[model samples]
Target: MSALERRIEAMRLFGRLVATQEGREYLADNNHKSGQAVVVADYEELIKDVMPRIRSHKPPVTIALLKDDELLMFSIGPTPEAERVSSSAASPESTIGMLYEAACQTSNGSSFHLTSWDRDATAFSMPSVRELLSH
Candidate 1:
């Protein structure tokens, strides 16, 4: 699939994962190990709130949703030049790790783990929901 198509599919998969109680629990459990942020807010409400905001932005945007106490924090910005630079480097794994670290910094001292979804070479190493659950 094209990169955009892959990203869309990833989002759909993420939406489906967050749509169920089991999936949410699994995500919460996996947060530490996977470093992907668990959506603490209502998925539908989050979509309603973010869609319009996302539409106003240009392409190559990065959106981060973080959990702080009882609130969900949203940080939307352009995908950094570092990301483009790192992706072209020899190690995509390191690039993904760097991205996750950058996302985590936005937590503002919140202890929750963070994750980024991208259609890069690193995507090949990501485990499926079933794979994550099986372990």
Candidate 2:
């Protein structure tokens, strides 16, 4: 697959995962005192191990994953304009954590700040987040 295709696939897998009860529980269990969920996995693990177990795909969404200095962005459907705004501002080192924090703050375990459906009214936003996404 092309890079964009890979990203889309990854996002779809992640969105499905986030929609699961197990996924939400895992995230909640791993959430730090600061409200950031400590989720880390390589691309292969996400695609191979995790994606397979999610039996349902509900509520298509967006997600961002950071590896080293790179930020990978994906959406289940069309890429939303807000996704561009946030991804651009993210510093690779902090993107995942910031996304987790935003998720908690917004009561959205899906990390909607990093990516969400185009029409999602609950998408997270803040000046700092906007700035991080802008970069």
Candidate 3:
């Protein structure tokens, strides 16, 4: 599969995982026990494992993982516009934490991360999260 496909697959898997009750409980329990989250590392590992398959077919769309305020955001396409904004503003080190926030939120959790995914070269904006919910 192409990189875009791989990334999409990963996202879909993650989305499904996060949307489950068991996964959310496990993540919360682990976080409570460890005091620090390991999801970021796990996410990185997953992407790394899939990269080879994706690269052979096509390069993945350039996604910029971002932490905006309290939101975890990612760009979802191969548009120059998104790339420019991401490259200009976000750094690699921080993106993981941002993504983690989103994962945590989506995992049947109490809160929602305020994230936006803007398509490159278009006015369309994809918000990972819609509203903030309190537990």
Candidate 4:
């Protein structure tokens, strides 16, 4: 498969997984365990917002995996604009975790990780994540 196809496949796999019962439970359990309320991001909006990047395919989008706001790993995020997740992300990290779980499964259980989708690969160098992603 092409890089774009691979990106789409991964996203679709993740979106499908998160829509399953097990996925919902996993998210709910994480929210319950956190004690602090977590807000679900409007992934649909995010997907729409990043559509231009996907179409041109000039700059490969990058997905960053961060734990407690620290960059852990990164790879190209090449999803197509047409195949967005059916629902908003369960948690900010859900997509990242799903992608990671499906693709990477790095050696660690979920504790605290952050995900940035469709951003420049160097997006995390800023003083704050809010600043990094804002660029």
Model 2 clash pairs? 86-133, 88-133, 88-134, 88-135, 89-132, 89-133, 89-134, 89-135, 90-132
Q: What is candidate 2's lDDT per residue for 1-135, written digit by digit as tens?
A: 444454455455445545666555543443312233222333333222322221133323333444333334322222345644322222234433344344445433232221222232222321112222332
Residue 103 of model 4, lDDT score: 34
List the RMSD of every prediction in angstroms: 13.7, 13.4, 14.2, 17.0
Candidate 3 per-residue C-alpha lDDT over 1-135 given as tens digits, one digit per residue, 9 for 90 to 100: 443444455455445534666545543443322222112122333333422332343221223222222222232223343234332222233333343444344333212211232222211122343232111
**Preferred candidate (TM-score higher): 2 or 4:** 2
Q: Each model's C-alpha lDDT?
A: 0.35, 0.35, 0.32, 0.33
TM-score between model 1 and native: 0.31
Candidate 4 per-residue C-alpha lDDT over 72-126 given as tens digits, one digit per residue, 9 for 90 to 100: 2223333333533232232442443343343343322212212333322211111
Candidate 2 least-lDDT 10 residues: 121-130
Candidate 2 vs 3: which has more lDDT: 2
TM-score of each: 0.31, 0.27, 0.25, 0.26
- How many residue pairs clash per model? 1, 9, 0, 0
lDDT for predicted candidate 2 compared with the true structure: 0.35
Candidate 1 per-residue C-alpha lDDT over 67-92 given as tens digits, one digit per residue, 9 for 90 to 100: 12111222333334444333322222
Q: What lDDT is obtained when candidate 4 is compared to the true structure?
A: 0.33
Q: Between the candidate structures 2 and 3, which one is better when assessed by TM-score?
A: 2
Model 1 residue 86 lDDT score: 36
lDDT of 1 at 13: 54
